[model samples]
Target: MCGIVGLYLKKPELEDQLGQLFSPMLIGMSERGPDSAGIALYGDPVADGRLKLTLQHPDMDYDWDGVKKALETQSGAAVSVDACDNHRTFDVQGDEETLSQWAEANLPGVTIMSLGQRIVILKEMGTPQEIVDRFDLTNVKGGHAVGHTRMATESAVTTAGSHPFSTGQDLCLVHNGSLSNHNRLREVIERRSSIRFQTENDTEVAAGYLTWKLREGMDLDSALEAALEDLDGFYTFAIGTADGFAALRDPIACKPAVLAETDDWVAMASEFRSLAHLPGVENAKVWEPEPAKIYTWGRAA
Candidate 1:
């Protein structure tokens, strides 16, 4: 079992408080998932032609500036690196594919967490509290965010096996429950698209499936509607994109999910406990997300 949480701010005035409000919601799931945790935050977008790549290395003291220099020299792109804990967000004015390829081939210990115009993903093998503290999540400002606290049953408890898997630009997915046909689905997606699986995690395959659907020109809601028919699983998914947040449950609705929306914001979690401490939750419209129903919020919708 795992815990998934998401928050989308409807008020621009609340953007600065996004992280402050989201921290407790994620930490509340520590009991449900003590193995690993991850978060995807949709913050201010970079320029239209630029993208941000959040990369992680095992060594906290790794020379990210040196890596930035190397990347700049190689790609001839004006790259800027922001270091936080063991992660670095590299803003690059270059092609995403080329930068990804260069990092894979040249940066030995670096792993690209997520690359997009508006999203930054940070994850590691630790409890939700530990991750939140380490990343200084309380200071992260964003319009929307989705997080996962993983209790690894389908894959080993490694950083790479953590949730909030990203298989597309500005998109990430966190899931509760397992996918029975993930192995077969993974093979099909790999053959059809340029996407590749990084670990033997079922959640990653679910993410890849969404990436494939979105690449096929389906909007977030349409893609999730199609997921009910194509993906076989007992799961609840909280998906975060550049400007949108969405939630979906399998047709059987075996995995638990709760959604609450106030006039100011919207939130979803694997359990309501995660939403209990949010501001104005008492007056929020709260309910269980129905089976196979796609719920979405944001400008992208």
Candidate 2:
């Protein structure tokens, strides 16, 4: 069992409270998933020509300044760093592929968590409250966020095995069930695209699949529709994108998920209790997401 929660704010005024509101929703699911916790926040887009790369290292006081200087000198990219706990968000005014390659070859202990104009992912092996406190999640401001708490039935409880896996820019997924065909799917994806799997976790495979589909020219909703036909397993998924949030359930719909919407926001969680404390939730329209249906909310919608 796992806990997944997402909140998408419809009003820009609420962006400042994103972290304060989202933290509790994540913590409420601690009983369902006490192994590890993660969250992907979307907002604060960099300039049109720039990208934000969030990187994680095991050391709380990693040598981020040295890394930044090396990156700027070698890659010729103007980089600004925002260090937070064990993670750092680099605003890069350069090529994403080149920067990623440089990091892979030079940064020995660093892991790229997420790369995009609007997404910053933070996760680690701990209770949801611990992660929140470590990252000071209550002070984070964003337009939307998706989080997960894992029970570790299939993989080790390492930070790399945590949910909210990012396989594409500004795209991440948190899952509530297992995929039976993940190994086969992983092989197919690796052989077909430039994307590579970073971990053995099935949720990573699912995220990679969606990334591949998006690269194939399908929009988010269509890609999710295709997922219903392609991905086999009993699962519930909450997908985070640069501009939107989405939820899906497999045909069996065995895993629990609830979606609630108010005039100002849209939220999804593995259980209603995760949504119980959100602002104005008492009057929000609430229901269980239907089996195999794609439900989406976003800035454009």
Candidate 3:
């Protein structure tokens, strides 16, 4: 079992609502996936400052001090690795892509899951506040975001086995449920796209199929529809990018999704309790979406 929660808001009247809202939503679901957790925030460019880089090494011989020093040379700022547990957080200033690339190359078996304007991900096999304190999310702000606390049912509880699997084209997907046809689909897609698969987890296959379709010239809606026909089994997923964000449940609707929408924002989760934390949303109208339906909620902005 895994937990997924996300919000797609229209142009907000206030600027800092993104952080205030997402932070609480994530904190609420921390108990769901105590094994590994993360959040993917989306926003425009911010002025250069320190960047938070989180790391997780399976053992104590991680050489974090040397790695931090080397990354400082590459990042041109002081670098530090937080707690030496299975998880750690970092702070960087330059380009997300540049730093992520460097981290990808140097930090083998590492993941640069998120790089939003105000927040980067600091999730690992631990509790919510533990990870949040590592990176200080109480102050970060953004337009939209998604957070996941993962309970690894199939894969080993490693850092890479976290949520918000990066789809590699600005789009990242977090899912709840199993894809029965994932093996066949993965075989076909990898042969066609020639893109490497990172983990044995089935979640990445959906992202791969969507990414492959997008690369092969398919729009998001069409891709979702195609996924409905091509992929078998049940899933409810959230996909986010800088341009827009949306969520979908499988046609069979074996999984659950409850959502609340207003002129300003749309929030969804597998259950009603998940929406209890949104600011000013205590009295907001919350309803469940119909089964076998494709509901798209983008930034109405």
User: Which segments of model 1 are wrong by more than 4 Å?
Assistant: none
lDDT of 1 by residue, 123-162 (tens): 9999999999999999989899999999888889999889
In candidate 3, what are the lDDT values of residues 168-262, reduced to their tens digit?
54567888887788889889998898555777777888888887888788877788888888888778887876555677888777777788876
TM-score of each: 0.97, 0.97, 0.77
Residue 59 of candidate 2: its Cα lDDT?
87
* Per-candidate total of colliding backbone pairs: 0, 0, 12
How large is the C-alpha RMSD of every model relative to the true structure?
A: 1.2, 1.3, 4.4
Model 2: weakest 10-residue lDDT segment is: 292-301
Candidate 3 residue-wise lDDT at 5:
81
TM-score of 2: 0.97
Report lDDT (CA) for all predictions. Answer: 0.89, 0.89, 0.69
Q: Which stretches of candidate 3 lie over 4 Å from their true place?
A: 46-109, 114-122, 299-301
TM-score-superior candidate, 1 or 3 = 1
Q: Pick the candidate with the highest lDDT.
A: 2
Q: After superposition, how far is residue 215 of candidate 3 from its true place, in Å?
A: 0.9
